[model samples]
Target: MAEALPRRPPPPTIYRSAAGEAAIRALYDKALAALPYEHAERLVETSFGTAHVLVCGPADAPPGEPDQDAELDPAKHEYGKWALEVLRGLGLVPPANADGGKGTAPPPLHMGTSFGAAVVLDLANVAPEAIRGAALVAPGGLSAVNPWAFALRLMLPAVLYRLLPCSLTAWLSLVSVCDEPAAEELEVVLMGWKHIVRYPPLPGGPSGVFLPDQLSRLTAPTIIICGEHDIWPCKATAAAAAALPDCKTIIIPGAKHFPAKQHLIQAADWILDWFAVKGLVPAATK
Candidate 1:
């Protein structure tokens, strides 16, 4: 008997200008439906304008989900336990941030927008070994075209009022603005979880952090898909497809940076297909 994936709340609406919004939204719906629908809907209110996004999608590795979903059981994916342990190590446990330690971790980024991409990539860079197969539709890496600049353009007026000019330059203001309230709450917890102590790679000396170039260390099976028209992270990410040991690349015709948004069904199918090929997911599962 195939095990069922654990269910969560209804998914929220998603949007992205970096990709074809309608196409991406359709793709997310199809994937969630394939996973059992779980009751997601389109929403009017959004974080970013007109961008297709996926609300409440399968969260970053939930604890014990393996035991709950027999298909995710051991002897199936060796990395299942490892992934959970990393989740635990990263302090993703329930009642997140029990100790009230702020900034000890990255802000609790929800996976529905470009911010999600930045957060996920940062985390992945932290623990690449824990991941096996992955599907990155689009990301807000330095490459992904972000409205952050334009959105900032729109918010300039309200932010400039005589009352709160200092708000823009304060510590962690961007994190607060880009993240949801729940994300802010977790960011508070993160403040407590500082970097693991290590010798500094440079003269500053002994800083507990790693730089972005270290991303090349990850060799897991990864698939980076981009649309023909979407700006940023398209050509480079696709090119990086061959950089990882077990990697593949695809550029969707007439598509843009947002593959899932520009070509939902095709994008979802590609992800499902990639996992099957990697043996992380059983062929029959699809």
Candidate 2:
């Protein structure tokens, strides 16, 4: 008889203790409570694992959109595909190539920030027909980044957590300018640093980088938002916008790598306006 295959180990948990998990949950709940719109939390089973999704907005909304955040790994495209499948299963989106390749359902929109944006682009390259539009914020992998510099900058927070693992250090590490939303984000970061047993290595060696040909394959209308002061991906974003057949680039003034809450709101307005222009959503009333 053939030997049995070894089972893969489970992924690492983010919290060190039950209390830490509870604290993070409390913060999440507080944020959700503050949202003007009602939302529901769902746990959907995917081929890879269970995905926790937060569903907001009206139930009869025209089309479904997925938003990704803070994921850097190139392998994230697999997860994105699974997420799209889940939406199809829920009847929130139409299946790939539905209705004999002439489906009437509106295609889904995708939005992502930083490394998540890279994953969105990967998905667009692989499955252009399924997506109608994309909004990318400070997307990485468009051009070469110094792996050492990027890794060091990303690891600074974790190093601070190791040396003085407190809320203050976490806040100091994240806050360029302090605000209410920044404080809330700090709570989550502090909990994560305090509890995570292992931190994944930052992507390197062309893991997420896309070539010119790959960028040109993204046929869907895309909006790339880059912060003026964002050192990493500004030039790459410009290059990507130039390459994509239907893409627009927006540079936010007085913004850095991670945009502030106000800047995020501005980005959202732009996305909504673009969607309206594309006939994906209704135009805002004056």
Candidate 3:
């Protein structure tokens, strides 16, 4: 995350006209327009009435398919595949892929991919009563991101980011955890390359699909966010939260899948306030 980044090769902002999509866009714009220049922050934090632990997970709770990455991209075939396999070796499946791929390879044991994060995921589904509040925005689980979007994430290496395309520069700068393109095997890639000439995964082969049930079990005060331009599962994610005991769905306008950057301030305000509402932090915290 430290190297110089590639400047985004500006592409004309293409407009799409779906109601939900429009809402997301308008919301992102409106949210960013509201950020005061002074307090804008890259990091978002909030404490709920409950012990606020911001745990990140894939959209669904199951491990993504042996290969499925909730976020996928066309140019990222190599990186995605690599990450998927490595993560699979560890066992932190992206919550969408329950059973590995279609074949009978023995499912991997628990993912030991250890990143020093304090948020204990097992607690996410079951918050203690004292932990009266919770807020979620695109956790760590897997979901199929647009192919182009996924490629944008892979354009740079971990420490060397300047390689990112200029137009996608901001996206590369945005916060994301890149995983592999799930479900596809070498045969699929070889076939596409041979026949289609340039067939990067349109939608991947057989990785795990996002399931609503993974979220249907949550029982905490929750806030969910979606980005306007976020094409995949934006509405579906919000809908999944509907069954939660307490939940609110928010759409960030104008922003795409990664609304955290566009609406970071607004998001911080909402998350903190949700915590404040439940009296988790001192009234003076805000």
Candidate 2 lDDT for residue 265: 91
Candidate 1 local Cα displacement, residue 189, angstroms: 29
Candidate 2 Cα deviation (angstroms), residue 63: 8.0
Q: What TM-score against the true fold does each predicted structure earn? A: 0.41, 0.77, 0.37
Q: Which candidate leads the pack in lDDT?
A: 2
- Lowest summed-lDDT stretch of 10 residues in model 1? 196-205
Writing each residue's lDDT as its tens digit, candidate 1 over 1-286 gives 5233333343232332324444544554555576643433332211111112233446553222211111111222222233333344335532223463665433231121233333334445545543555565554442534345334532343344224434333223333232122433333222212221221111101221123353354466666665555544356555544445666667777554333333667767777788778776667453
Once fitted onto the true fold, the runs of candidate 2 whose alpha carbons sit more than 4 angstroms away are 1-23, 62-76, 100-103, 144-154, 176-181, 199-206
For all candidates in order, the CA lDDT equals 0.40, 0.65, 0.38
lDDT of 2 at 211: 70
Better of 2 and 3 by TM-score: 2
**For all the candidates, what are their Cα RMSDs to the real structure?**
16.7, 5.4, 18.6
Off by over 4 Å in 3: 1-122, 126-131, 140-144, 147-213, 260-262, 282-286
State in Å the error of residue 264, model 1: 1.1
